[model samples]
Target chain A: MIRKLCIIGVGLIGGSAARRARRFCEEIVGIDADPENLRRAETLGVIDQGCASLERGVAAADFVLIATPVGAIEPLFRALAPLWRPDCIYTDVGSTKGNVVEAALRVFGIVPPNFIPGHPIAGAERSGVEAADARLFEGKRVILTPLPESAPDALARVEAFWMHLGARVERMDVGHHDEVLAATSHLPHVLAFTLARMLGRKDEQAEIFRYAAGGFRDFTRIASSDPKMWLDICRANRGPLLELLGEYETALREVAGLVRSDDADGLYACFSEARAAREKFLKSTENNHA
Target chain B: MIRKLCIIGVGLIGGSAARRARRFCEEIVGIDADPENLRRAETLGVIDQGCASLERGVAAADFVLIATPVGAIEPLFRALAPLWRPDCIYTDVGSTKGNVVEAALRVFGIVPPNFIPGHPIAGAERSGVEAADARLFEGKRVILTPLPESAPDALARVEAFWMHLGARVERMDVGHHDEVLAATSHLPHVLAFTLARMLGRKDEQAEIFRYAAGGFRDFTRIASSDPKMWLDICRANRGPLLELLGEYETALREVAGLVRSDDADGLYACFSEARAAREKFLKSTENNHA
Candidate 1:
């Protein structure tokens, strides 16, 4: 059991971690740049104590979870470098792993043996301490991209911590994690944001939204997610996201060509393939959860 | 009360209409190219009678609703033109209005005064008679694009029919309806299908899907919709859809440029605007329902 757990950036992800980790840790401390969030976290019983100072937060903690945006993680590591404890297991819930890994290297010249970069594939559109839920990570997949220098015990402890909170953990290479996430998460968000912007800016925007059905609403729901968080993710995972966007644009152009030529058979083939693939993917995920 | 209501293409939309219309009409007749669909519609009590022949189905029916895919609407219009009755009011639930209007003109040398083109903005990923829901159109918007020659009584009757089924009816020009729907519905579906196809065909398809969370699932849910139906929509509304696709591609490229340049502020602005717009749109829709 963790003697004490420190969570930095105590918003939705951090606050949620603190809430669930309370059962497995003796003490839970939350550190937030925003004093209001820190206060809310403490009052909500999501954390046992709140600290405005990062040094005070991690003073005697055996585990530290940095749950900031990808862009802020590097500076956070720099702040933690001097007070870094070798025996403590350090991890993060950043959306992009490569950026977090790079941040650690830039901060300390190399990833410390106890600093494991991880991402939990779970979230809600709402953020802040008030939205924290103890069951946020239940049945969710948590990917840990442990560096070569990462202590074996540190990795094991991090995995066990997530599992204790009802998450399924998997290990992956940092670069691969970024690429897969770019395809599945980042690119989708970009498309959703772009689509919403395009339609929302139209002169007929009111009428356009009035006629939109459940399908359109579902397709663009991600556009309502926290913009600053998504902006950081898009910036952190730019290379893979841009590559996928290029490929997706090409595919869309091909479909447009089919429509232009009135090639019913070609259009049918493209849509049918997508439908079958999505159905198969959904079935596999259901089986995984089962 | 209507003497009889004939419904063609008795799948999800048509079957749903039949089920709900049973309360207002004396009898409901269903006609489908698929014999099994017709049989199921009758057995499920979604229709009072089933007929394989179009002529036999519409005999003595004062109201006829052609609920076929956009691709089949013209041919159905041609068939109905030969059997046209002066007193009966005819309407369709095709997705594209311009195409339906053109079909009526092409078949009868002019749009019949009694024929009204209507589209109900409600659907599900699943199709066929088995997926029919009596409440499918409840609280949904139904767009009616009545031609200049359309009989006032006929348009009023069609509007009344949809209102009786718990839908809000609005009349729009045929061309304008196509443009608005292309932006709100068709383009979103196209994007979903393209994104799903691009990621699903990847070599790491399994890994990509395994890490994808609720956002990706919700964003691509429309990709699971009936392929043939969407193919018909894309083809029938090609002009407006292509125009919107080009505009959308340009917008995507601009967002990509922001990412490539790591212009954090620009990315934040774009995403923030989208989030705010979507939230506003959602609020308006909620208010509409309220």
Candidate 2:
């Protein structure tokens, strides 16, 4: 029986998961390097016990969730590998998966069958335990990419846990998962960041900033996400991100060529197709259930 | 004394402007080709009266704003030129100013000194009269592109009108306005539409749609904006938008090449720098008095 839950990092996702798991789990312990975060999580009742040290948090744990930055995940798993109870199941809430799995293999000697790689496709630009809410995952999708060696029972438990928190869980191969997320998530981040960088100059920033209505704010909001976290994500998922970036460049260049040549018909056809596609996708969430 | 106001196209911006102008002007009449939109505006108390004909809307007005699409504005202005009242000031709320101003001059024998080119940098992606709100322009920036022959009083009155509705107004030359907006607004829209078009597929869309979270929704939300409007914008501002698209492609290609070469350090640096710039912009906005 997975009676106790130990969450490392205790930020938005970590604290939210802890709060949601409270209904099912008997004990929830949270660990964070930041003291203020630990205090906030404790105040929010995200965890029954808050630990400043990793060792203290991992003790008496049936499940361990490392919710640190992508770059830190490898070192974290390495540090906890020997200390982690053999019976304890481990998982992570990283945005990208292939790098995380590879990092785990490097740290822990033979991949643990109890380890289930997972990513909860939910977040806000404003992060931290302060922004944590139990409903963050409500009606959202959480993707789990389990290795063939991963124990089915362990995978089932993780899926059940996420489902209890109102998340729709789905499974995919690690390589395919990275590529899809690159198109949907990583490439978008790159575009937002690039555009924000181009426009964020000190000279033009005031004018650009003043002109930001709902569309600009909404479009570039993710560019304001945690720099360290995104840096780690880019470094880890560089391959797939680059592939999507190439695809994005091809599309942009084609439109640019059209615009340069004053091809109004071509431009109109492109925009029309995209607009139709966006409408269709937004109007349907039925595929999410499947 | 600008006691009466006339607004053309009674859609979101036109209807909202009519409602907000009521606070400053004694009477507001709206003209729309779509009878349903005009009727809806009348019922919503956004205007004092509705007219199906452009001449009827502009004939007895102190101030007339042609708030139609870029393509429609030229024809609307041409149709009303014969019936235009000499004392009545004319302006337009079109996205691209150079095209509209040139169109106005080519269509009208003599462009009125009171004609001001303006764009209120505020709107929701959701369009139509029903979505119009008087508070849409509140605390937003309204950019005016004044010609060399523009009447000083007329320009000031237009600025003051926007100010009275709680907007901060700025003035720029039409050519400069197009270039700036191309970088800050038009290019972003192009990128959003292109990304959506490239990634959107009938079979793969289901999974991509399912995996879409905060980042994807925020970045591509504008992709769902009206295609006809965007297509017109692309055609009208083709030169600057094409140049800006090239700049974006240059950045995208650099990142793509680094990713292809497995240069994790380069990718991390790029992501971090972009994120930092975005953070700085977000922080600066919080300090603005407006």
Highest TM-score scorer: 1
True contacts kept of each: 0.81, 0.70
For B1-290, candidate 2 gives per-residue lDDT tens digits of 46778888888888888777777788888888889888988998888899876766777788888788777877777787788766878888888888988887888755578788899887777888888888988877789999888899889888887888788888988888888888767888888888888878622534576677767877888998888788888888887787777777777777667667767777667766777776665665564434
Error of 2 at A160 (Å): 2.1
- Candidate 2, A205: how far from true, in Å? 7.8
lDDT of 1 by residue, B77-155 (tens): 8787778899898999999988888877788889999989999998899999888988999998899998778999999
Error of 1 at A163 (Å): 0.4
Model 2 lDDT tens row, A1-290:
35879999999899888878888888999888788889888887878888888887888789998888778888887888779676888889999999988987888765688989999998888789888889999988889999989999889988998999999898989998888888888888878878877776622534655555567767888887876677778778988887677767777888888777877789888888888767766755545544
What 10-residue stretch in candidate 1 chain A is worst by lDDT?
A202-211
The lDDT of each candidate is: 0.89, 0.81
A1-290, model 1: which lDDT tens digit per residue?
99989998889999888888888789998888888878888888999989888888899889999998778998888899899988788999999988887777788999999888899998988888899999999999999999889899999999999999899999999999999999888999999999888888883435577778788788989999999999889988889989988888899899888888989898899999889879867976795587
Candidate 2 — which residues are off by over 4 angstroms?
A: A33-45, A50-56, A202-206, A286-290, B1-3, B23-26, B43-45, B108-111, B202-206, B261-269, B283-289
